[model samples]
Target: MDDQQFRQLLNRFGFSWSGYRKVRKGVKKRITKHMNALGCYNITTYLAELDKSDEVRKKCELLLTVSISRFFRDREFWKSLEKKYLPDLIDKNIEKINVWSAGCACGDEVYSFKIVWDCLRNSLGHLPKLEVIATDINPVYLEKACAGIYSSSSLKEVTEELQSTYFIKKKGKKRFEVNALLKKDVIWKTHHLLSDPPESKFDIIFLRNNVLTYYEDLLKKKAFRKILDSLAPYGFLIIGSHESLPFEPKDLIAIAPHSFVFRKEAE
Candidate 1:
């Protein structure tokens, strides 16, 4: 589709310009493939077909959702979480600690947190009840994540020690399957950040890279408000290292220097 037509289509779905820009090239490729499958030779026909078919529209939405991610994608951020954040959070909460890994693509981020928590638990000699909720809008991603299998590349940041402890090498393959222990407390679901309400109160919300980076100002604000409301007092909100809040919530304050981690001010 042409730029104007594409923009109009995305606007209809409440997707912002920033989100469109991030995935424009990939969207175009997906659309062209779909158009060919539908035997449509032009953007006009394709748009008309998309308007009429719920399946086609859903496919487009999946195409636009950014899913690029890896296990422990940013080394330093995980270090900060394990060495600094988790210790403090564990000390403060006596009940089950709830963690929501929003937009958890292919489950790497969720598993990453479990690995860190497991390591910390070993040293502390005590552990809180832990429950992890991993959500994504894309069911395909959710399916893959549920399988808990990954290529060696996706595990690049995982140390040899961790890999040996937490993953099983597929006997004759390069892929690794996450150990069953790590999957015990994780719950996965399909959710849209803007349209869906918060699932539950969370001590830590990994609201990274996706919505905040792709959404326009208005949607970002709305999503941020929802996230803030779901956060427990003094809860942590972690965004991508490169991302910043479009407008900070009154109760959420940045906690770590040069990091996107924030803490909800306790009342």
Candidate 2:
């Protein structure tokens, strides 16, 4: 598809072009693959087919929503959470913790959080009720996440200690499967950030790379507002290192220097 046609397709699905320019080549390649799979000889035919079939259009949307993810993606971010944030949160709410991994692709981030929690719990000599909710817009990703198996490349950031502790090497395969204990507490579901309101107050919400960086200003703000609404008093919000809030919401305070971590001010 040409630039205009691709942009039109994305626009129809409520995606903006803020960061589309940089990823245009990759997006076009994906579109071409989808078109070929659908037996369309040209962009014109594909567009016509896309207009007629909801299933095809949904597949196109999934293709455009890139699902690149890895465990402990920005290592420093997780370190900051372990050494700085979690301690304070634990002090305040020692009995329970609620964490939401927004845009959690294939379960890496969710499992990462559990690994950190396991270490912290061992050090503290107490176990709190940890409820982790991982959500993504794509059903295929959710399915993969539920399986809890990952390629070696996706586990690169995971330390040797963590890998040995939490994952078992798949027999005769170059992949790792998360241990049953780690997977037990996590709840995976399909969710859209823009339209769905928060189901419950969360102690910490990880709204990293994709949701904030990929969309336009208006949608970003809308999603941000919903995120803020979901955070409990004195709760934390984590975003991608390269991401910034579209507009600062009132009473949200940055917790560290040059960090995407912020805490909701208690009313």
lDDT, candidates in the order shown: 0.86, 0.86
- The residue pairs that clash in candidate 2, if any, are none
lDDT of 2 at 258: 40
lDDT of 2 by residue, 79-197 (tens): 87887789889888657888999999888889889888888888888867989999988889999999999999999998899899999999999999998888888889888888775
Stretches of model 2 off by over 4 angstroms after superposition:
21-23, 39-51
After the best TM-score superposition of candidate 1, give how far the Cα of residue 113 lies from its true spot, in angstroms: 0.3
RMSD of each candidate relative to the true structure: 1.9, 2.0
In terms of TM-score, how similar is model 1 to the real structure? 0.92
Prediction 1 global C-alpha lDDT: 0.86
